[model samples]
Target: MATSKDGVKLDKSTPESVWKQILSAEEYHILRQKGTERAGTGIYNKFYEDGVYKCAGCGTPLYKSETKFNSGCGWPAFYDEIPGAVERHVDNTYGMRRVEITCANCGGHLGHVFEGEGFPTPTNQRHCVNSVSVKFEPKQ
Candidate 1:
């Protein structure tokens, strides 16, 4: 299994049965199958608590809560990520062109990121992420 820069063991090459045993059905679909949850229906769509967001598949830290913003796009939106936390791909599925973002460590699907929108972020990018693809660790 591949590991992330932060030493999180990736779940790649694990059996489907093993993944099914560890992750919820929704989580597997989003993180492994690259399926997206419906808009405005994600648990983190409106959640803005202070903490870090980690990849559900490997527990690698992805984004700090301070980078999250309300994009009104339904899913959790982040303007930035922890350095080297994710990889990018070109996605042309569903007749739309998008940049697909995945966990750099385990290669789990996090979601898509878009650019050129006029958002008040340092990068002017919006990471449209799936709630099922991540787990939240609250700050003390």
Candidate 2:
């Protein structure tokens, strides 16, 4: 098991083919091909239950319920991620510069992180994630 910078255990050995088999086509597209879900259509976009959002690809815990906020951006928005659970990359696709966030463990695409939008959150960074990229686990 690989661990993130904060020592959170991660699994990186799962083969991509296995992921392809495990995920639906939509999930594979969003999580593997970096595709985005249509705005306002995500299951989690309006859900506010207390839970942890895990990467749909590898089940790595990514965000907590407290970090979630309605950014009105038509996606499930989080002000932050579970420390070291996600990683950032420079994405220049679609003729725009953006910071892409992914599962640090499985390298699955979650979405983009936008900063300085002034969302009244501690980080002020909006994690614009695809709903198909995460699965919610209610607090137990």
Candidate 3:
């Protein structure tokens, strides 16, 4: 299992400060407090170049450019994530049961994952990621 920059284990359990230092106020609210950004209001929503998307909080590789698809969910959508790079938990915070996706390394929330997308992918999973949770590294 890959560890974070500060050596935090890439699992669901991690220290709070590890998350705090790596993320900003808005990032913390969305990733840790389960706050949602308004749809179609993220910078990455307009990104259309080729690149890999990584966790902004910990620099962990999350999604590849190839796996990205136009889901029209008003956020960056991907069909898959890097192997063993994320962890999911059942979130019941907002009076609904949803799988909350987080960075495996630092426990920073990326977004949610859902099934039955009917996309042309093996998993048929749609990872609705927050643009604030990720940064794109454009391919040269």
Q: Which candidate leads in TM-score?
A: 2
* Tens digits of lDDT, candidate 3, 1-140: 54667676644465667677766899879877777789999888657789889887767888988888778889888888999888889988769898999888767778899899698877899999999989899997
Considering TM-score, which of the candidate structures 1 and 2 is the better prediction for this target? 2
* Model 1: colliding residue pairs: none
| lDDT of the structure predicted as candidate 2 | 0.89
In model 3, the clashing pairs are: none
Residue 118: error of model 2 in Å?
A: 1.2
Worst lDDT window (10 residues) for model 2?
1-10
lDDT of 1 by residue, 10-81 (tens): 566656666666778899899889999999998899999999999988788999999999999999999999
What is candidate 2's lDDT per residue for 1-140, written digit by digit as tens? 54444454445676667667677999989988889999999999999999899988777889999999999999999998999999999999989999999999899999999999988999989999999999999999
- 120, model 3: CA deviation in Å? 3.2
Q: Name the lDDT value of residue 87 in candidate 2.
A: 95
Question: Each candidate's TM vs. the true structure?
Answer: 0.90, 0.90, 0.82
